[model samples]
Target: MVSKRGRIDTFVAKRLQIPKKMVRNLIASEQLFIDGHQVLTADTQIDEFSLIECQGNVLQQRQRAYWMLNKPKGVVSATIDNQHVTALDLLAGIDKDLLHIAGRLDLNSTGLLLITNDAKWSQRLMAPKSKVTKRYLVTLANPIDSTYVAAFAQGMWFEYEGITTQPAKLTVLSKHQAMVELKEGKYHQIKRMFGRFQNPVIELHRESVGEIRLDDELGEGEFRALSTAEIHSINVNASV
Candidate 1:
């Protein structure tokens, strides 16, 4: 659920197209049930994902939605942007207002981007203790060397944050390209790390997050609902 902070009376009235007083009556009379429990107060908090029933009629029963986008370069990972096309704009007809980006990519970065209506699920993945790994394919302006690999493994210190980064893995694929795996994401972390060598990142693309890989079949700017297995993978080792 995007938000579970709504009051029951307001939620019920809107869903049933009835007055607030009538919805309150339903709650007072014990006719309203949320997730099979009788509602005792009109002020009881509820969310769109809650299964609400009134006298055997289900009023709202929304399931959480999860999606993965093969993000295209130049698309902002946002719900709304005044100057650029946002990631939500690419969903077309779907009810995107309820969804949010789980892991964000830079405007110029491309590849696997997770979108979901489940906040807890996203929280579990992003939580530092979870240590969920993110893999990125990077193209650099300068030639790569073993020194970069050692520096990354030892973790670099960021002066702005006054903290050392978590150790990251760097696999040199070519003279100018490499694969980077990190357990944490800091603001401009990758770019800043490479900035130590005065090496600008020419290209950056996420290849995967944790156990879910970007689907090869999806073209740029295209997206699809995540599979049941993919959605459950994040919960396998960590508490959600």
Candidate 2:
């Protein structure tokens, strides 16, 4: 009940208010039927929306939830932390632990943070081989120029990794602000890339990920469940 996913035996025990051993006995007795088929194993995985009928009584499934948060600065992208408040703390009326951060925003950065319980969906988005584009609004301490376009398009070398980053798209929005799009994530990538020109980053915010753009109506710290179409935008095809 508290979680959307769990073993069938645990659900049976909770629903019947009996011990797990009793649930196992009931499973052995063929009293538990999952989706109308009698199951001998208590380990049958069930979701929040599973139709579990045991001796004519129906067990409800917990509906999966997905959300997008306009993450505010200073909130760490984590479920729990001892020193800093996490983005999950900003959410209300949901099981925070059940949800996960698909893409992390740095403590000093903000915008378009996705929250979901679907592991496969998140995995697809984070897969290194996936070409899903992440767009960011970057503020720099120096003025912008056309040379950055060619440099970013060609990729930047990070000495620490001894590897050049994947080609990125950089569009100048203003003297101090620019739009940057990348298909891969690197540690402090934008900051490090700009550091090559001695141009420090003043501010950073993620504007979008793939086809899912940040909701203009949602304020920082607020979130809403992703629409069906929005969820469909995630491309799981890894082979290209």
Candidate 3:
């Protein structure tokens, strides 16, 4: 027989309107007990047969979350700071305490951005072995040369301030615009790469990552959580 009555500690916490985290902290600090047995983890999943008490403080569950933010230009992708604006600021009314960005877009660049508290999934996308190809649409102030296209695709090691980078996959989508894919990410990379040819970027947008494209319906500064199908597809495509 199953009942929703719950365990001793669980019943006590729920009845007293106390949070489980506080209950855990109480247990950790030796301020709580269950039938004279000391509690260790909050995950004890207690029933009416147990006992629970909190000397002081409250507890709450951490909400797990994931979201895509249509990051507008001039937003920094960091948390825990007072600045003009951070990508986390875009999460207003969103699940607070969500983790870091899966990949980064430059502050001056605008487009799709993924934020999730899931460390494992975040690590998967950021892993070097995954080699997830990120697609970017770049509009240059000047027309692109065909010779540059060949060299860009063949891989051009960008050297700046004594630091050199590996080659990237580059292609020309049009005369004044180009489509480039990079398996590796660096600080302000795309902008610097085009700077070498005296082509200043007029506009930039990240179109896709692997097989998942940013939803076209999303306006600037808008976002939605990715479906499970999209998440699975990233892993599947990375394997191929």
How many times do residue backbones clash in model 3?
7
lDDT of 1 by residue, 100-199 (tens): 8998999999999999888888889888988999999999999999999999999998988999999999999999999999999999899999999999
Q: Which parts of model 1 are misplaced by more than 4 Å?
A: 1-3, 6-24, 40-45, 55-58
TM-score to native of every candidate shown: 0.89, 0.82, 0.70
* Candidate structures ordered by lDDT, highest first: 1, 2, 3
Please, what are the lDDT tens digits per residue for candidate 3 over residues 1-240?
121234445654676778766655666788755555566766566542234445543233344456778888888777655765888887777765546788988777878788877665667777777888788989999989777766666655655545555567777888898888888677777888888788899888898877778899988888888888877776675543
Top candidate, metric lDDT:
1
lDDT value for candidate 1? Answer: 0.91
Best by TM-score: 1
RMSD of each: 2.5, 3.8, 8.9
**Lowest summed lDDT over 10 consecutive residues: which window, candidate 1?**
1-10
lDDT of model number 3: 0.71
Where model 3 places Cα greater than 4 Å from the true spot, the runs are 1-60, 160-167, 237-240
lDDT of each: 0.91, 0.86, 0.71
Worst 10 residues of 2 by lDDT: 231-240
Clashing residue pairs for model 1 = none
